[model samples]
Target chain A: MKLPRLLTRPIAQPPPHPSAQLVGDLAARLEASARRRLGRGLALRHIGTGGCDGCALELIATRNLVHELESLGLRFVDSPRHADALLVSGPVTRNMREALEQARAAMPEPGFVVALGDCAVDGGVFKGSYAVEGGVEAVMPPDLRLPGCPPSPRQVLEGLLALVEAQA
Target chain B: MTPAEFLRQPPAQGPTHALTEPQWEALAADPELPLLALWGEPGVVRAAFQDGNALRLVALAAPEGQYPALSPARPAAALFERAVHDLWALEPVGTQDGRPWLDHGRWPVLNPLSGRPVRHGGAPPQPEFLPAEGHALHRLPLGPILPGIGEPAYLHLAVAGEAVVRMEARLGYAHKGVLALMPGKSPRAAARFPARLQAEATVAHSLAFALAAEKATGTEPPPRAVVLRAVMAEIERLSVHLHIWAQVLALAGPPALADQAALARETMLAASQIAFGHRLLMDRVLPGGVALDLEERGLSILRDALLLLAEDLPRLARATLRHAGLVEALTGLGVIPPALAQDYTAGGPVARASGVMVDARLGPDASPYDELELEIPLHPEGDAAARLRQRIAETAESRRLLAVMLDSLPDGPIITPLPQRGGEGVALVEGPHGPCMAWLALDDGGLIRAAMARDPAWALWPLAEAAAAGAGLEQLPLLLAGFGLTMSGMDL
Candidate 1:
């Protein structure tokens, strides 16, 4: 019995994407930093404060096989209590300000904050809207800021690596 | 009047018809005409409907800061009316659910989009979830902030034992005051707002906005630009459908298959970046025409990417069907009856899965799609499985459309000069999710006087609530993944 051509044909393996390579390098750096300073892996808790979901989609892409950050002992946790970092996205809208503060307060001492997009960094396109309180900085200071309309997965990994290195 | 009767009348070339109060009420209660969108601007409120082939807009004056409620007749008008009241301080005379829709009471100004904005100082009001009373029933609250990277939205679930008795979603956590932001800016400068309304449907929303602006100014983009816009839209649909498949597969089982879907999506994104200079194709479709042209090298890259997706998607679908765990988890789960879907006017895969054959691409406003071969996938089951299958079918159809458009690629300039002039225009484009409508009133200087972009999610969210009513509480995420809705699009 012969299988259909679709099942029989080998799945094409495109060359490793440049973002994958950048993620690999960043993972190596983060792993070394974790061993040297924290004696444990980093745990991040993400919150979408209120911009478009482009940054969130890119952030999720970082967990894919090509950019598997989890393999480097870094993972997203369900609660801020278990997190070493609070990864915030969007413009920190007024409706989300309390929720954002509550998540930050629940984290352990010295848990850093990383703002993940232009909206999070300084309210990018939604700057003067009445519904938003500008950016993450308006609610609380961020330890690191990654800016793009919404940064790519490679840029996200790079930003994480920078945060880890600076903390170490 | 029935849709057939409305179609018999001569088509009105004007953007909107000024209807008397009685006429507006009659149209609202017609039952046969599906309401596309209802929005307010100053002293007027406009309602758009699918009048056979063309979009019909009817306007009524709200001089006393109030108007007759359409929700009394068309149950689907409930959300739209609530949103209008929230943003414009226009009272819906006899609405059953007059709760604040988009204004969560946290904004610095109340009725921010109203002509005269007022400052509010009190603490934001807590949401009032619908009551669910039963013995041993407990409430389960999820989000505004949940586990995993997704948009923020609050869900209140009333569960009894293992089953959910009721589910009410309190969204508006992601609202950015988009309506208030668009009014004063030129269409070129304000194009970014519509593009950002829904990240997954950026191209669809941008195209709809551009079409509305172009129609308002009576500008016609070159032939090449029209075809390229359609090409980009097809690519967007493919990518979004793939992403939804990846998410559904991740939830149902067989993680390896999920990876395959994710990789395919990545390939599409990479191709988009190579062709249009942006992964999501944001800001690529502007008012007069597209911002960038497809060069020869980029065109070949896109062709190769589409071919790869065409081959890979079928294998993933086959694997998914063979997995018994996925099959059992999805089959007969979160079922939405066809009657309920039609009543709510659900669109996209959700509506198509329930056997609704409506597609904006096949409508009168569909330009290039009118020339291309477009197929509407229909499933009678209306389950999670059916929705997934609908996406798979749509993905194949989009691939075929892309191949044809690329083969017959036209040659010409990409843009036309949009003269600064006053007019109103409405456009409906079939987004990946469903029919997305954009209506705009342009000032003499081509600045936007008023605008509204409606995502199909508005109709689908209520259907999702209906689907979740009798399902097990554990199945909530699977049901949501099946719907694949974005809160920003709704909240905007």
Candidate 2:
């Protein structure tokens, strides 16, 4: 009797870069940005129009034990106006359009948007539904799109971190 | 057939109409009046029942036209009856509200079978606004169509100066005729739809379907498969609870709890990676057995992961509870008092949070759950805080269970073959969200008769009514977060 392959595959190798110089430049810039925005803190808020809740799940996970995202000082806020970054999920249904617009408008300036999951990126399988308005991109341009049926919490955290640095 | 005998039999045949006197008495004593059962054929259980006074009804998915109309007895059944009527074109004996459930007003359609247009045209009626009754009594119209983070639902709040006098909910935006979609597939293949029914409880859905199929076929997955399924299910539960807890925290305004949320995500991904190879653990579960096995290394990884999570989960739990704003906002708000929780047929942590000791796995007469020593925690408070606390405690227990199951791991063939003529089956598994039930019927050729997945929220929706009571219009966000019902589960 044969045993099935049960071990999880390893992460794929990332694209190559100019080793030492690229690392130094990236690290220096990231540190500089972090230092500049140290006390202000980034406020994160998430909205789910109608995705499978995968992104929402991962977003929540990113804040917990494995990801420990709070170490970076990113916080979630209630109102969009209080947020420095908006994490959006779902395909932006017709019913949710007004709320989405209201949230976007309420956000303070110098904010970035992170689109989580395939639904937010392209509406995935739910695209053709009459009530669906396609992806979040259909409603507003996203600064960073973290793609996955629902990206891992670490991926979401990384995306948020990258957006904050870029904005900073 | 006696209820005991019927319960013992695989859920293959149309539900045995014969009921023992005690069983009939129990059914009769149900607080909800008017449970109508329809059996269009010998072996299909298409039942509809409801509580007329509560203004809610439950329509179990079944063969087309087999669902009966309880609208004559219960006003709430009127909406569901119309929905079933529109989708399957199944004629309800008598329907009160003629408005269609799934049909969006454009009714006339060319009937290919009759070669004529079938139309039910009615004059568009004037929109009568909610009438004010007396001094300080005015209707606060919310939305059947609102924005932000929810499926299409309308809320009608009768308020006077920020105080709610009455609340009503209108839902059906995401309904996709799932019951109508289940026929024609094999029982095993049909099992696929249930997990998707409520993505959060996918593992529970998978387990219930598999268990039901197992019971029908008179086979259980090898010992190893059972343990693996349990491990995977627990991990899935942890993932969802963590998500719910974080959302509750965020909704109550604590930005710092994202760390806990991230940790929960890590646990979910790691467990899925260790057990099934996919993050969401999709397609990993199959009828009769699991598609993958736990290799030695994967087992160790799981053992280690569970240990780590168990050690660290407490701090995250404490942080959320200790947070001043969260406690103040959630402590007494959105209470699903014990009595109401039961009336709503609430399941999972929501039901447990309200002191109901109902769990599919914990039933003494049940299988795998009967084999394992299951401990359920119940609280009588039944508020948002209790629900959150219940989740935290359950997360710890789930971690312990996963660790134990992995340590006592069994080894054997991963997948079990489905006989050429797969049979009917039904499963009831306790999920993190609540009781998740899956039912399947296979044809002689192994094709599916009907597959249905019922989420705990089917019962918990009424609790929303209780939670919405007295909640001001502005507190809608907290109320929604606290109730935490999954719209996708019902929509599918």
Candidate 3:
């Protein structure tokens, strides 16, 4: 059966797991950058301007005891201005499109954007809704994508860790 | 509509209706009975009130003019009326606070559901938010984007120094016009909207849609299907309550306590995946019946998981509640009185915390809940601590129900064939949040004519404002977290 043309748009697909090669390479780079690091800590900001709360729940899971992204020196910041990277989830609703843009703009220079879930990548089931604006790429392209209705907490951690390693 | 036509229940057991629009005001007058369902269509609007097993429904067909809005008499009708005006353009005469609720006036078309063109102009400017003002109080706008909040919703908090004097939530950032999408699709296809409303509560929503579809189409799932659907719903509630407990803990304090809660929740999700093939349980329920059945291995995993959780959860709840800081912080913050809860129609834990005894599970609805020895835990204080304790109690109860269902798993076919005919039907399911409902009308070709899925959160968000007033600004997170309302559920 043919899929709807709008939903068939190219969305970044996650590798079965995080790219071990890139994650390793980035880890090496981070280890040698103590002098370059400002050491203000990893102030990551998450934005889920639309879509269901699935990705947000899994993302929160990464902060709990089992996944402990905090112990990895990462923490959530209240404002986008204080963040090093923007972790975005869900399809961008039309109303939230501007807020998403403004949030990305508020982040200081060299900040990366990581989009989570199929909704963020390709708008998932909400693509055809009149109130929705297709996907995250419609507003700003993401540096990383983790796909699923909600990618598992392990998958979310892999994506965030890889993003941090790349920045380091 | 005439009183005689209104004084009848749908063949399927939806909240029963028996009054005209004017009588609806009388139903609203009884503060003890909570109003459960409210929505509108062209020519008519409907409301359902619940008292134990009995439901009093009222439908008003305006004689080609504005009908009175119950919002003036019932504060609970605020969101439903605003939404009715926004979507159907059915002006509620004498309605208070008619400012757009769902529509931000940003659409190229006004009343898109009613198919009206944008009225001779571009979308108007975003209106300024005029909140209820007070002395020495300043407004602090919260979000349409918070990294941690899963959906796009804003909160206007009236603050005096460090104290939150009041809260006004502005949602609709996630409103996807679900009703608009419902029409023209087959009931099977439309099932996706109700299920996706809130992923955490997917089972309850889908079950509601399935129930509504089954009712409208005059089809029935096999006995086995009903038992399985109930089990899935209980599992969904378990996972949700566990996750909410963890979230409330993490948002407040004691990250270590949150971790234990997450571990138990993860165990449930893993078992759910092993049984249902979906961690979130989306699309597992379809119209007329379930999409599939759980295998023996899946049932065993769930049975084992429940046993472990039953032993571990109470210990976790005690440890967290006994913590000195938690006790001090949660004790008196965000106390909504029983009268206010009834007035605002606070739902799920929020309503139950304030001593509102309304549970669809315990009602005269056609479900196995009437068969099982289930307990709906409630609290009287209506404070953050009471809400937290309420969740802990409900989580334990959900686990107990899961064990009972799994042990007595019925043997039969899982689904009924989808009907090709059309009719009007309504479904009510007690979701993790509280009671969620769905209404659908099918066309001659078996396409959906109109549909509405009522999330319990829609009625509860306004009560969040009442709950947050007079609490310290720092305590707002705990207050909001304990209430555990979802923004997407509200907007949709």
Candidate 4:
């Protein structure tokens, strides 16, 4: 019996997975370099401020088999206390301003913030709205800024790897 | 009464009608008309109702800054009324729950949407949750910053031991003041807001917004654009359903199946990126038409993705069912009663699983859907398993539709220019989660005068509260994952 192409393909096939040839050699090397530098994995605690779920969806996609940051020494944690970085998305709204600060404060020493998506980086299209308080920088300093209305799963992985490598 | 019978007294062809105060109250009292959405603008308050095949809007003058509350009779109008009050300061007289819905008193100015905005002074007051009175019941607050990659919204679960006595969600933490931001911008410029309303349902929201803009401007997208829009919407539904399926399986145990489902979702996202130029299909659908027409490369990519999904989906479903533990975990958990679902006018898989047949795609005036062979999957079980099965069935149906659409692809100009003129329009599209509705009034110069995009999560969130009753606290995440409602979608 003939098997499907996806199932038949070997699990580890360099970088190109299925459709979009997103994960290339650079992403893999960054993953390895970050892992070596940190001596462990990076744990992220994500918080959504006031933007759309575009960035959040990409973040979730990074956990899928194609990207699977978990296998490459990056993971998401439930509490801020367990996190090594606070990955925040969206334009910081007034309502979530305090919550974002509290979550940032809860992170241990040497921990940094990664602002994901254009909204987080500079409030994107929602900038200057009465409710929005600009971007992550408006509330707290961000160690890394990944741009794109929402950076794709591949972009998100590369950004995280770069952040870990630089910080470590 | 059937929707046809409910619309026996047909309203005019236009979107809105000015009604007297008494007429507005009488219409609100009428059981036949289910309140689709409510919003306030300046001296007038508008309410939309699904009138058989068409959308009907009724406006009442609120010159004194207050109007008779529809929530007193409609129940579904409660959140809409609260949101209207929060944004416009148009008080809902005699509202059962007058607490702010979207505005947490955190904005710099009060009545931000009102023509005359007032600056706020002191720090915002703490939000009050509905009190739960019972012995041994303690309150547990969940979020505003939830686990994993989900959006933020505060959930207060009143629990006695492990069982949840009651659950209340405090939303608006993810609100971006989308309505307030759209007024001065042109339709082309404002299109981004609705598409970003919910990432998972971007195509659906964009399509609805585009349709509303098109209607307001009296423009029709070419046949190819219509067909392409349908294809994109179907792909979004397929992708989101798979994502939810994976999350549910991951929580229910069996990581292998979850991995397979996630892989399938990733493949779909890749196809979307290749075909539509955006993974989530955001900003692809615009007021005039689609941003880009599908070329040979995109078509081939989509064909390959569909072929792969066809082979993988059924196997994944079968493997999921083979696990007794997974089946047991999902079955009979988070059941939403059909009556309650109908009361709140739930749509999409949630309503279908509850035996309340409500899919905007299946409505009489659902254009491209009317042309395509569509199936409304229904299950009386109304539990987590039922919802999962609904998605699987719908995904299969979407795959079939995509194949059919690809085979009979139309050739034409993808867009038509919109005329710069004053008009009002409303549109409803069946999204991944449910039916998303968009209402907009364009100024004479084609700039947005007022707009409101209502996500189905607004209705589904209340049903989530209902489904959480009597469930163990640990099951809350699984239950929410099954529903897959977006906080940003509803908050906007």
- Which regions of candidate 3 deviate over 4 angstroms? A1-17, A20-43, A71-73, A165-168, B1-34, B53-57, B62-65, B117-124, B128-133
Error of 4 at B396 (Å): 0.3
True A-B contacts kept by model 1 = 0.71
User: Of models 2 and 4, which has the larger DockQ?
Assistant: 4
Return whichever of 2 and 4 wins on lDDT. Answer: 4
Q: What lDDT is reached at residue B370 by model 1?
A: 81
Residues B26-139, candidate 1: write the lDDT tens digits: 676677776778889888898887654467787889888888887887777889998998888888888889899888888878888778889988988878878898899999
The prediction achieving the highest TM-score against the true structure is: 4
lDDT of each: 0.84, 0.61, 0.76, 0.84
Model 1 agreement with the true structure over A50-82: per-residue lDDT tens digits: 878999888888777666767655789989999
Interface DockQ of each model? 0.67, 0.16, 0.44, 0.72
Q: Worst ten-residue run, lDDT, model 4 chain B? A: B1-10
CAPRI classification of candidate 2 = incorrect
Error at B1, model 4, angstroms: 14
Number of the predicted model whose DockQ against the real structure is largest = 4
The reply for model 4, stretches above 4 Å from the true place, is A1-7, A11-40, B1-13
lDDT by residue (tens digit), candidate 3, A64-122? 55566776667888899998878778778877887889999999866667788998888
Q: How far out, in Å, is residue B387 in model 3?
A: 1.2
Fnat across every predicted model, in order: 0.71, 0.21, 0.64, 0.87
Which digits, one per residue and each the tens of the lDDT, describe model 4 over residues B1-492? 443253444556556777788777677677576777888898789987765435667788999999988887777899999989988889998888989988888888998988899999787888888888888898888888887777889999899999999999989998888988899788888898998888888889899999999999898889899989999998999999999999998898688788889889999999989988889888889888899999999999999999988988988888887789988888899888887876777788998998888788876338787877677778889999899889988889999999899887799898888888888888989999988989899989988999989898988889999899889988888898989878887888
TM-score of 2: 0.72
In candidate 1, how many Å is residue B201 off?
Answer: 0.8
